[model samples]
Target chain A: MIIAIPVEQKDPDACVSSTFGRSGYFLLFDSQTNDFHFLESTFATGQSAGIRAAQLMIDNHVGVLITNRCGENAMRLLSAGNIQVYQTIAGSARDNLERCLAGTLSRL
Target chain B: MKIAVLSGKGGTGKTFVSVNLAYIQDHAAYVDCDVEVPNGHLFLPMDRASFEPVDVMIPSVQTDRCNGCRACVDFCAFHALGYAGGQVIVFDNLCHNCGGCRLLCPQKAIIEHPYNIGSIRTGNFEHVHVVSGSLNPGQMQGSAIIRRMIAQTRPFPNQILDCSPGNSCHVVQGILEADMCILVTEPTVFGANDMRICIELLKLYNKPFGIVINKSLDTRNYIKTFCREQHIKVLAEIPLQPELAVLNANGQLAAKQPEYRRIFQKMLKNAHSLVAPQNL
Candidate 1:
């Protein structure tokens, strides 16, 4: 099962890699192979799925979503599409995923 | 021409630009679609000529026809309708108005009816129509009233939709329908970051937009550099003028000032150049 992880910057401006047009993250996680590939979501999307976010999820057939804190509407939408949303996992994408797979993170 | 001033984040002066722009335009309609907290009415004094109520349709299932099969609960993708044993509960706030449960129910117990989610205040402001949409405090679906407010405009009128914060349905609803979206942003990391989210949604909707840097903190290198690399047009730059902010706080439109009238006029001109120029 491939999963999608939503990410945000602790402070984008402080980061040096031009957070201008860059996205947070819509990472692709291969559960079977344990390989992680990320797709960027458009900036300021926060947790909402914009065009790129939806497109990436649809194109990649993401079955699960991991995020820090997602909006209620977004959680419902993703859940409706059978995408399991794991929320309230604090920290970076890698840390959250580890927690999610370990079955120790709380979901909103 | 419908112009939406939006940002992915809050406090970037979306309503500020919207109120002043509408004031300067004179004949235009200004709609504060930020139903959760519509502040546009603060800057522009309205005459309260007329006001109307807006309602949204929500599903209300009749228990008599419910077979206790839990069919409605199973069909509801939003978990809005839930059944534990026999009794079914409808969480109105979670309902998205998608009408999926009603269609899927075999007993036909799910009936749709209008729910009063908000009210709209319509008034004349110096020849401009000032409209404010206020959502019911506990209601979650404020975007429906926003759309209704947009639909109530006069024929071929230049309108400015002062959108809400974030990329929720409210923001997208404003951005998707507007002719041109004038993104109100600041030069901060959070501002530009939020603007970038707005830009993605606009691009997704295939709408053209320009950036309006508001409340410039005398440092705009990051935002300008980002816009430069993205090939986006940087529109009028409104510096962090505390005088304008104070004036706005006191329910005054900056466009009322003789010195800044030209800026609003030019913004109107720029807005006219975007999609739906005929509306301008």
Candidate 2:
């Protein structure tokens, strides 16, 4: 399954962005292959950025989303896509991914 | 002629000036374009009011014929559409009712639906016709409602458009149909500063406008100084009186009182000369 984490930077060690919609970059991690890549967020400063960000995750076939917080509209869209949202602890993108894989992170 | 009363800052008495101006005129229409929080009805209570719901077109997708095209989703500039779980979801609030999605839909799956954003209330207060727009709570289509109200009140020769605070798109809609504008402002540094933006907007639109200093404490104040420097005409000044405040707080029309009646009458006459100097 592919997990998406809104990150501050493209690097795996970048801190998870506090905001899901206006995040600068999204780190897409493939849990099965232990591989990952970064995708730049398009609607970071646009209107309804949350909805656009959620749509980006849906288009990329993201099965899980890990972030600090999610807006109501974006949450509804994410839920409609059947993507499980997990709450992330304060740490780097890779650390949150590791915790998510270990089943230690809680569902948001 | 339609005169829009506007102030860039809130609580500068846009409604106060508008209500009085409308009240003083014979066969005038009071248009409350501040739809988000319309309060002109408080002073000029409507009698036998008729309401009409304002609706905007929102697109709905028929998933069966959508074909997973993603055309509508990508076409929306407002990002009001989202595709997930092989289905498209429409965020009604974010949609500006542009109808581009419905037009661009290749599969004929997208259809426009009427969504009620607000209502327009029209009634009579003695000789003055009152038309106020009330936007539904959490709705962001004040501009659309203002436009509709302006169109409806076209037959009335004299109009006082009470604009919402600031130079937002909402204010732009309010001033669009107006022949002249009356900028009501308070005598303060902040009030004078904010009024500059509204002046700039009027200049950009090339609309003739004058200023009315509300809540004035003295002859020499911030608003007066700024207006002099800009060479803008000061139409009238409403004194900062405790009795006026009390009467206004109780939803009483200041123009109804004998003393304040002359003030509004003169203000209206000055505002008339702004657009029609020949009549002066």
Candidate 3:
């Protein structure tokens, strides 16, 4: 499964963004391949940023999303795409990713 | 002459001034462009009002023919469309009804339909024709309704557009149809600050505008100082009287009273001189 987390920076050690929709970057971690990459959020400043950001995750085939918060419109789109959303703890993307893999993170 | 009355802050008496201005005119059209919560109709009671639904084109996709092309999904700038489960989903609230998605669909799967978001009510109140735009609850297309109402009232010789507050898109729609604008403001720090923003908007649009100081007190205030420094004419000063408040609260036009008639008449005269050349 591809797990996505809204991150403040490109690095895995970067802190998770408090906002799900307007985050600067998203860290995509693939559990099967043990590979990960950063995708820049292009819709951060535009209207309906949450819906566009959620569309980005859907287009990227992200199966799980870990974030601090989500909006109603974005949440609806994520659910329609069958992407599971999980709440992120107060830590770096790497730390959250570990907790996610260990099945300790709570669903949002 | 079409005059738009706007205020950056609410309760500065946009409707109060609009209804009274229309009341004093021999024949004028009063347009309530504040679709969200229109109150101008309350002050100007009309007889035998006619209503028409305001509709906008909303696009829907025929998924059987869509073929997961993603053309419509990518074309929507409002993010109202999304591709999921090998189909396109339309979020009605997010849609701005731009109609680009239907035209851009390669498979011809998208079709446009007229969706009613609001209605416009028109009636006659003595010499004045009253037109009020009311948006449906939870609808986000007040600007569209305002545009429709303005188009219908174009042939009228004189018009007073009661614009919604705060320099939003609704205000823009109302201001775009006016020959000049009257900014209603109060004598407070917050009121003056908001009036400054409205002044910038008028300057950007190159619309000739003057100020009306509502609820004025005996002492000099921020709005008076700001208007003096900016060289903006103070078209009228409505006194802060308890009687005026009582009349307004009772949905009465202050101009109907002998004491307040002169104030609106002077305001109309001043507004005319300010825009006479351009209007002619």
Best by TM-score: 2
Summarize candidate 1's per-residue lDDT along A52-92 as a digit string, tens digits: 24334544777776655555444444554566666634356
Could you report the DockQ of all the candidates, in the order they appear?
A: 0.03, 0.88, 0.65
Model 2 superposed RMSD (Cα): 2.3
- For this target, which candidate reaches the highest DockQ against the unseen true structure? 2
Show the lowest summed lDDT stretch of 10 residues, model 3 chain B.
Answer: B271-280
Off by over 4 Å in 3: A9-15, A89-95, A104-106, B67-69, B277-280
Pairs in steric clash, model 3: none
Residue A68, candidate 1: how far off, in angstroms? 21
Residue B49 in model 3: shift from native, Å? 3.2
Please, what is the TM-score per model? 0.70, 0.92, 0.91
- Return the candidate ranking by DockQ, descending: 2, 3, 1
Evaluated on the second chain alone, the candidates' TM-scores are: 0.93, 0.94, 0.96
lDDT (Cα, 0-100) at B127 in candidate 1: 77
Winner of 2 and 3 under TM-score: 2
Candidate 1 chain A lowest-lDDT run of ten: A12-21
lDDT of 2 by residue, B12-119 (tens): 999999998999888899999999899999988989899999999888998889998888988888788999888999988878888899888889999988999999
Question: Among these predicted structures, which one has the highest lDDT?
Answer: 3
